[model samples]
Structures are given as structure tokens and as C-alpha cells.
Target: MSEKLRVGFIGAGLMGHGMAKNLVERGFPLTVMGNRNRQPIDHLVSLGATEAKTARAVAEASDIVFLCLPNSAVVDKVVLGPDGIAEGAHDGLIVADSTTADPTETKRIGAALAEKGVAMLDTPLTMTPKEAEAGTLNVLVGGLAEVLERARPAIACFGRNIFHVGPLGAAHSLKLINNFMSMSMVALFSEAVVTARKAGVSVDGLHELISAGALNNPLFQKVMDWPLKGDASGLQFAIENALKDVSYYNRVAADAGATAPIGATVQQIYALANAQGEGKTHVPKLMDVLGRLNGL
Candidate 1:
């Protein structure tokens, strides 16, 4: 029988914790790196997963290293900086980055890793931390088909809906495009809500009209309902992260020489929210940010 792969996980925060837990529970020999918060690292350690001192250590101790960080900048720093994955990576080692990153950076990192005989795959994730916990997150992969097949089992531990989008940086590019549309919708929705409220329209009435129409979607429901219930925690994604993704999207559009007026507009709105100290708030709370901006 073939042996299970040795898996190392970096970034044991909201989304990473559940993903790491499933890898360990699925019989993989898992090693998790320490993060700012000890609770997740301690919890993973208690589940028979070993803890590593640094990203390099985690990479050295495992066959497949999974990164679930915030943005491209952090991903770049962790994989290419001092004491990073590149330092400890060996020939034939696979690095799967699950962060929504810049496609250009992903390509550059993939090239660097390739020179060292380390294969880098862009495997950006969809869904939320809730789905991450349930082991049903959606994974969009971009790399060699054979490499994806090899990593499929471990990825399946946390992802139920997985798609091999294309080669190298395609998945990250698609992720940016996807996030642009989603965030744009949320921004437009928030603006509509704030405008309606100013005109003395009921928020619940607006929700009812939209919910009963073809415009309703799972994302719309999630962004609206959670906030209405006074629990924006259901989304599990921060406003700053949303801004980061939209900014990445704008960059992608600019590089492609395509005009992205709406994307640019959404980016500005998120920037405003972040400037108002709502960076750490959940994405759904953009409603509150917009409301406050309008003096509501």
C-alpha cells in the first residue's frame, strides 16, 4: 500500500485551522507552524499533529506544504523571505498555496520553486471558514495535472468541490476575477441599502423583495441575513481581506489592459471602509460602514 504524504501547514488561523485539522484526522502525518495565536496551534497539536518552529521547519519536515495565508504579500514573504519555505524545500517537494494571491506573484514564486526542483501549485480556496470547518470548501487549482492528482486526497480532506482551473497562475487569476464580482455585488448592495434607509425604506422590506426575486443568491443571503441577525461572524472573512482581493483584481485587470470601472469603484468603497477602521470587521458589515458614512 502507498504511504500517506507528510503534510505541513502554515497559517493556522481561521481557515487554516479547520483545513489542518482535517489533514491530521484523515491519517496524514501533519506538522503545523506556530502563528500569532496559540489556541489553534495547541488544538492541532492535541490532535496528534506536530508543531514546527518556522515555515522553513514545516517545509523541511513534510512532503507537501500547504499555505493558507491572507494575501499575496504575506504569501510571498513566507515562501520567499528569510527562513521561508524556499529555504527548506527539497527537490520534488510540492507547495500548495491556498491563499487568494496575485497571479503574477504566483508565477514568479512558481518559477523560483521550479528552479529548486520544488513544484508550486496555486490552489486558492472559495467558501468560508464555516465550510472550511465542515471540510466542504471549494478549491480552484492551477498547475500540472499530475501534481494535482497527487495532492487530491489531502486537499479533499478539506475541500469537497475542487476544480482544476488551468495551468500555473490561472487559478489565482480566476480567483481574483471571482472575488471582484462578489465584492462588487456586496458594495452595490450596501449602497442600495444605505440609500433606501435614507429614503425611509425598511431594510427588511428590501431584503424581502430581493429574497423573493431571481436576484437572490446564496452569497446575497449570507451577506444580508447574518448582519440582520446581529451575527456577522457567519461570513468569517474580514473587510480588509475583501479589499485586498478587489485590489488584486484591479491589478489583474490593469495588467490585461482591460478597463475595470466597476472593480475600481468597489475597491474605492472598500478602501473607504478600511480607512474608517472597519478593516477588521466582517465583509457583511460593509452595510454598517456605508450607513455610518452617510451619517445614519
Candidate 2:
């Protein structure tokens, strides 16, 4: 453990904070940057992580840098921007990008990093910050076998399940598809809940009936937590993030010459929610938004 590779983290938001803490707890000499969220960065600093001033500083201090940003745009800005990771990166530095970003952008970035002898691994994550804090997240990785091996030890500190999906950008593709499916469920179930109320079916009854049948799933339980228990804490993901993922998914589908009519409709549902100013709300509260729309 004394010879462990040094690690750097660029985002300290909900999920990033938890993962950064796990790295420190697992004995990685860690560096972190204060993003829009400061609490997690401060907390991590208290627990022995060096607080860097910029992404470049973070890269300069570590063997591998993890980017858990909002999307490809932000990720690109932080990684390739002035004083970004690319500026401070040395040859052989590995970047494990955990942001749910565009696969095309990932391939492009990976190519850019290649010239500097920097390796980019698309290591998008699943599950929640709850699992992140517990060091039990499922990490989908896309990179060469050797690179994944290099990242595995540190990733295992916070990731319970690590799947080396394919080459660069594959993990991001899978993540976007996964989010498309899950976010669509959140939207579908939210509508069903609203319809149940309008049609005189109690929310509890609907939940119980579904729980008794095959329709039950972890996603359902999380989404229904709001309508059934007045808690959206079960799913901490924001609606804005959901919209971004699904939009990314749409790009993935279109690139493959596929028609995602259902995905298109689902995207509109989230787009309306975002336009209605529910972007900052958690996914579960979509029930409330749809309810108000239907006069429920």
C-alpha cells in the first residue's frame, strides 16, 4: 500500500466527494480540486486529501486523475481548458473519466491524450452516492486491458463491481443507454402515479400491487419513494442530469443509424420538466410535476 499510485479527483459534488473519500480511506495519496461544491472538498481535505486550486494542479500531483463532472462539456472544459488536466499531465498519466459523457467526445479526448502519452479510460459509474460513500459502486470501464488493470486497484477502493466493457468510449455508451432506460422508467412511473391519482387509485395501493407482481424493481422502489413515503432521497439524481443523459443517449442512437422513437418521446417528457423549472428537482419529484400538469 505504501507504493500505491497517487490519485487526483476533479469533481467534489455528491458522487465525486464520496468516491474521493473512499480513495483516502483506502490509502491512496490523494489530491482534489474544489468544484462548484465546496463542502465535500473541505471534508475530504480534513480527512487528509490535498486541496488543489485547479485541474492542472490536480493532474500535476497524481498518477491518475478522475473526472466526475456533469457532462462532456464540463468534463472537456476541466480536462482540456487552460490550467486543465492536459496542461499538467505527463506521459503515462491515466485519466479515468467517470463522467456520463458522449462516446464520440471520449474517443476524441483519448486520441488527444495519446499524443502526450496520457491514457483516457471512460469509467462511468452506476448506483448512487449512497453506494459511493460505501465503496460499493458499479463501475463500467472502457479502455485497454492494461490500463484497466492499472486503474483497478484504486477503483476497487470505491467500486464493488468493475466491468471492463470495451475500448475507449464504450463505457460511456453503455452508461447513456442505461440512463435512457432508467430515466424513461422514472418518467413512465411518474406518469402512472399521476394517472393513478386521477383515476382514484391510491398511491400506496399501486405500489403494493406492483410490489406483489413482476413489475417490482429497485428503480421502481426508488422512484415511488417520493409518492409513497414523501422521500426523494432514495434517488439523489437530479432531473437536469437525467435530461442530459437521455439526450446523450439520443445522440448514441442516432449515430448508430437507429430510431429511438420511444427515447425521443421520453426525452420530450424530461425536456418539458426541465422547461417547467423542475430541472433542479430530483427524478422522483417528477410525479409532482406531472400531477400538477394533469391537475392532480
Give me the candidate number with maximum TM-score. 2
On residues 111-228, what C-alpha lDDT tens digit does candidate 1 reach at each position? Answer: 9999888998999888888888889999999999999988988999999999999999999999999989988888878888889899999889989999999999888887886546
At residue 197, candidate 1 shows an lDDT of 90
Against the true structure, candidate 1 reaches a TM-score of 0.96
Q: List, in order, the clash count of every candidate structure.
A: 0, 0
Off by over 4 Å in 1: none
Backbone clash total for model 2 is: 0
Looking at candidate 1, what is the lDDT of residue 278?
88
Candidate 2 runs further than 4 Å off:
none
lDDT of each: 0.90, 0.92
Give the candidate number with the greatest lDDT.
Answer: 2
Question: Could you tell me which 10 consecutive residues in candidate 2 have the lowest summed lDDT?
Answer: 33-42
Error of 1 at 283 (Å): 1.8
